[model samples]
Target: MGGGLPSDARTMVVYFDGNYVDANDAKVSVFDHGLLYGDGIFEGIRIYGGNVFRLDEHLARLELSARALMLAIPQSRAELAAAVCETCRRNNLQDGYIRLVVTRGVGDLGLAPWSCANPTTFIIASKISLYPQEFYDNGLSIVTVPTRRIAPDALPPTIKSLNYLNNILAKIEAKQAGALEAIMLNAQGHIAECTADNVFIVHQGEIITPASSSGALKGITRGTIFDVARDIGVPIREADLTRYDVWCSDECFLTGTGAEVIPVVKLDGRVIGSGKPGPITARVLAGFRQRVLVEGTRI
Candidate 1:
């Protein structure tokens, strides 16, 4: 693996611009609008036991994000899906993460979208682990950062664009404060979401999270948690959340494609209920794991 060749191929292959290529050769241009202007859309999908989990949903979201940004995808849905599966096959991944990106392609040095000729696309399949086992076993530590989410009117969170300086600033705050994750608020001081994940809290036996309107991205894992909660007979809903609510809630957790599901035991400085993963959180995680293996596009 010295020169980007893995002992096994499960993490060293890529699909770039309609061709399968070695990771070392798959490179984007310096002038690509995606790199220069953060003009792009992406999706992080997961594969479980050789099956691509919820590929259709991820593709749908990608399409929606592209439409919102007025970006043209170079490939059709079927073609993109095929490329994803092929990338996984080339990498020989049994279980891994897939990152699909569509960029505005190379453009002039100036800020003109029309200067770009075509869109750039790439698919990468690789291994991912966002947190250590101990964190998942015990719980994660997070803090509320000063950086608020980007206002919906300015740039909707639903677009899933590459412009993530807002969240990155919040992450920097969390890291500086010795926290594993950061919770961001909207302009109204209402909870939006974590820097890299969606937030969920259990209060009085009812599970709740911030509505997407509050500036949180509707994550695939977050939606699956709703399904998981329902299968386990737990009530769930979307509502406004606050720092006080997180501190007082019976339990809390974060969800993402990379993070899967992780329990939260503390926020800011207050210890959450019992300071450990709760019964409901455990059940929902288990249920979500079960669904990952059974529901997917078989690769």
Candidate 2:
């Protein structure tokens, strides 16, 4: 199939398997279980100021995800880190997004995973497009979708697996509802997270987010926000949250590798506190931006 690229687009160099190849030349077998059965894991990392933000944390998550699937990465953690930096160097990226993926290698059509021998690994580094500047200033309006997050007993959210149809379905609902994102609840009807980000709210004077037990991914950005909150003298905690809590909270925001930290002014058509980015949210976001420039391994 054609890559459907614009003729003027730059040709990207992608790390395929163990070698770097042109984007158009990078290919994986159709029989790969990761393609057919979503038997794999991935991580989305950020490069800020020529440094990879939270590189070690992201890699550790990737390794944990792979172990959960009984998949062995082809390279050690140090080697993988080098590969990521080399890809950024080749792309001449001072700031960008990095996608590291590991798939169960080629296998027969059978559901048996043991049939696959080697795992496939690849990395892609490219520019990131964040939410519109207006959204950052005014905040986002979101809705709660009917699609709920998968139960941890069935498929743990902490795995960061390639199978994201649950999130995609919720995203579709958000789009249909004229919103940029959707809020997903867990099996017990407690707030889990957004389609692809972690949810946070400010109540009274504390910053609150759903616990990992609520089926939310252990987001790297979410962890960073905890530190940011502490640095800014804001108390933070993790607990089970409900829609009512969000509606009544003083502030709301979502955090992720791509979205960074974005405020939510309205949910389900109800205006959030003051109908604007709250003072606490603004302080935390500013602190996060400053921390990004100085933390993480230098590329």
Q: Mind giving the per-residue lDDT tens digits that candidate 2 earns over 1-299?
A: 85565442258889988798888887889999999999999999999989999999999999999889899999999999999999989888889899999999899999899999989999999977667889988999999999999999999999999999999999999999999988999989999999999999999989999988999999999999999999999999999999999998999999999999999999999888999999999999999999999888888
Candidate 1 lDDT at 86 equals: 91
Inter-residue clash pairs, candidate 1: none
Error of 1 at 155 (Å): 0.9
- Evaluate model 1: give its TM-score: 0.96
Off by more than 4 A, model 1 = 1-11
Q: How much is 293 displaced in model 2, in angstroms?
A: 1.1
Q: Score each candidate by Cα lDDT.
A: 0.93, 0.93
Q: What is the alpha-carbon lDDT of model 1 when measured against the actual structure?
A: 0.93
Error of 1 at 201 (Å): 0.3
